[model samples]
Target: MTSLSDLRRALAPQPGEAGTAGGSDRPPLVVALPEGRAASPRDLRGWETKAALAVGTSGSTGDPKVVLLSAAALVASAELTHARLGGPGTWLLALPTGHIAGVQVLVRSVVAGTEPGVMDLSTGFRASGFATAARAVLTRPGPHYTALVPTQLARLVATDGPGLAAIREFDAVLIGGAATPPSLLARARAAGVRVVTTYGMSETAGGCVYDGVPLDGVRLRLNDGRIEIAGPVLALGYQGGEPFGEWFRTGDLGRLTDGRLEVIGRADDVIISGGENVSPTEVERVLAAQPGVHEVCVVGVPDPEWGQAVAAAVVPTDPDTPPAEDDLAAAVRAAVGRCAAPKQVAYLPELPLKGPGKVDRAAVARTFG
Candidate 1:
């Protein structure tokens, strides 16, 4: 495991050092490792030499790719985040260091010249453990900040214990790595949590859009319903792919409403059932609002009748008293459309997650198999 101090020293520019994407004397690429994994050197034959860090993609839909990020991009993201959240302060690391989200936490703390309180995720994230970490971070200074996935936020909110109370003390809590349910966001805000929804990926240096708005020096535009981002925060490119041009075409389908980005779903995630295109995100949104539904993942499953059928894997508020399958289907049918209603529903204690907060749709689809 690379220590936080090691990362900071590697990322920080030395005296008279030139840190740019075009710089000839670039530092060795630092690979972010997942929890419990030892660091190892990778074949860097075709990788971008100017990149400062190499973070792996979650591969929720396919095989993971290595994303190369430059020092300039990481610094820009951290500075913009601080400017957006009213200046940098102490930060807490609640995510795995292997992911871009966790790496950015360390980067921001390094930029702020502050030590971050790290959470022990070897045993997995728990509200009790988070509360303890939050207590230690809060004791340091003002304008405290932390980043988390929606799943972590949900746990803290559900616990309603010292965890939830501790979360309310932070100046900002950035939620990303997946689409957040509006109901969950509402509940967190109602409970006094300063939750800021973020939308970005490893290719964009973690998050370049905060609460639907692009960060400073970041530009966003929609092309044929697909989200395209261009800015300093953008990554150099995938390790083996061509360097990004003016715009990085994101796989997410989104639309801008009054200048704010509204992500619909993944471009490849749309389900075609009976010749009608149904967005799983829309169906999931409807199902999430239904009473007794805690978390839900809508996926397309192969069906003999409809060619493809909409299926939902739901994590109920109470495992013992899961929501009625027909009721959940009816909710989606009413809110989205009849064709969007889930034909199959599976109840679980929790939705299977890939990466940080993203639900594993492929696994959810497999549940119907």
Candidate 2:
């Protein structure tokens, strides 16, 4: 009858317990058995291994996989982050702890020897709720911090009161969970919110790249345009116990320019429309920046003439003044090319969210398919 709290401690490797891949003389660390329900961690059985945590991945795709994280990996991630973002500090837990992003908040707290101020996600996210939770976080010593999805940050910026003010005071606020629109980033920075866009997932122990720059000891490469990351912070492996090799190849498509990684979109998400490869993110970025658009998700749907057609699901800022389909399509055409223009547009109240507030591309595609 091990409670989740006790399991967390048993899984947390003690000092000096973490060593290089196969050279650690210490007995294997926690196996991190996963239970979606209450009271996890049963018999060690054949699961005993060198992993400290088990996390699940999130993407636009419906498929999600469990990733195994090592103590060294998590420690390296937190240490490198502290060095980059002005050292460890108090953190407000605004995300669900079941995900890697949420798990890292607690992990960073442990590394900093502080307790995190938890946000009541059971009641859904609200500016008032975040503001109240953030106030308590700032009361602690050291630089106050918090991580959130773009939706939460956008809401804070829109609210423009205690929530935005509280955000302005933090040393650094991490925004991840999905691709953040540049407009949103501009808006956040304009309000004096130190929003840092993070890239990585459960496979990388949360985010290994901060603001498009790889953290210390982390490396990035593009294989045939797909992102492959290698670093101390990389996850050990998946469940069933197959350890990763030198690098973990991600589904993300991106390029490196002057050592900075620029994530484009998912490689698998490329749309072949009328024999041209259309990047959904490129279209979405263009359409989202339009005046009336609040948020947008672009997906390729089945088309008779072109085999596949580019489509966009938009959330208009003003429901009464929804963006015109032609304007959005023209914008995309002007930016990327005609091949990237959306052939179909669906205006919605909000884009569908997958786990942890990421845009659910599959669902969006199904709606417009």
Candidate 3:
């Protein structure tokens, strides 16, 4: 794992340096590696020379890509975030450093000139450990901030312990990396947690959209239902793909309601069942609101009659007393449509996670198979 000191040095602007655009004296790209992995500055074929950091995609949906982000982009994102969150203060590193969310925390710390308190995830995320880290961060300064995924938030909210109380003290807690269920968000806020939903990817320097609003200098548009982002916070390009033009087209589909972006599911994740397109996100949203459903993930599976069938894997609030499959299917049918109803429902102790907080749809689909 790259140390915060190393990242701060690499991201800091050199003397007499203007910006990264069209610069010959660009810093070498630093690859953010996961824990237990080693990465050194070296010449990588096809990578942009002007790039400052190379972070790997989460690979939750499919094959991962190596996203090249410039120092200018990272700084722009961090500054805009602090501006939106009132001011730059101490940050706690809860997520892994290899992912964009984790890298952004360190970048924000460097930009704010504050040392960030790190969390130990060697045995995975625990509420007790997070409470301890939160206490350590709170002792430093005012307006402390942290970022987390939906899965982590779910755990924190579910457990009524020091974790929940400690998190309520932060100025803002950013939740991203995957879709946060409406119920979960409402539950957190009702419990005094100032939860802010975020949307973006490694291609856009972690998150450029907070609480459905684009940050300063970020622009959002819908090209045939697909979300496209353009701003200084955008990455240079993927390692092997074509460089981004004025706008970087995102794979996720969304719609604008009163100038606010509301993300639908991925365009490729639409399940075509009986000649009808069923959005898994729509189904999941409806099912998530139902009683006893703690977490849920919907996916399309092969079916002889419908060509594709909707299947759901749910983690109930209580494993011993799970929700009824018929009730969950009925909720989806009422909210979405009959075609969107899950033909198969599996109750599990926990949903399978791919990267960070994202659910592994492929793994869930395999459960039905």
Point to the candidate with the largest TM-score: 3
Stretches > 4 Å off in candidate 2: 1-16, 19-48, 59-62
Candidate 2 accuracy as TM-score: 0.91
Q: Where's the lowest-lDDT run of ten residues in candidate 2?
A: 37-46
Q: How does candidate 1 fare on TM-score?
A: 0.95
lDDT of 3 at 213: 96
- In order, candidate lDDTs are 0.87, 0.80, 0.87
Least accurate 10 contiguous residues by lDDT in model 3: 18-27
Q: Give per-residue CA lDDT, model 1, range 301-340, as digits (tens).
A: 9988998999999999988999999998888888888999
Superposed on all Cα atoms, the candidates' RMSDs to the truth, in angstroms, are 2.0, 3.2, 1.9
Flag regions of model 1 displaced more than 4 Å. 14-17, 21-25, 35-47
* 1 or 2, greater by TM-score: 1
Q: Which of 2 and 3 is ahead in TM-score?
A: 3
| Root-mean-square deviation of Cα positions for candidate 3 versus the true structure, in angstroms | 1.9
Over the stretch 144-229, how does candidate 3's per-residue lDDT look in tens digits?
A: 99999999998898978999999999999999999999999999999999998999999999899999999999999999999999
- Model 3 pairs whose backbones collide: none
Of candidate 1, the 10-residue stretch with the lowest lDDT total is: 18-27
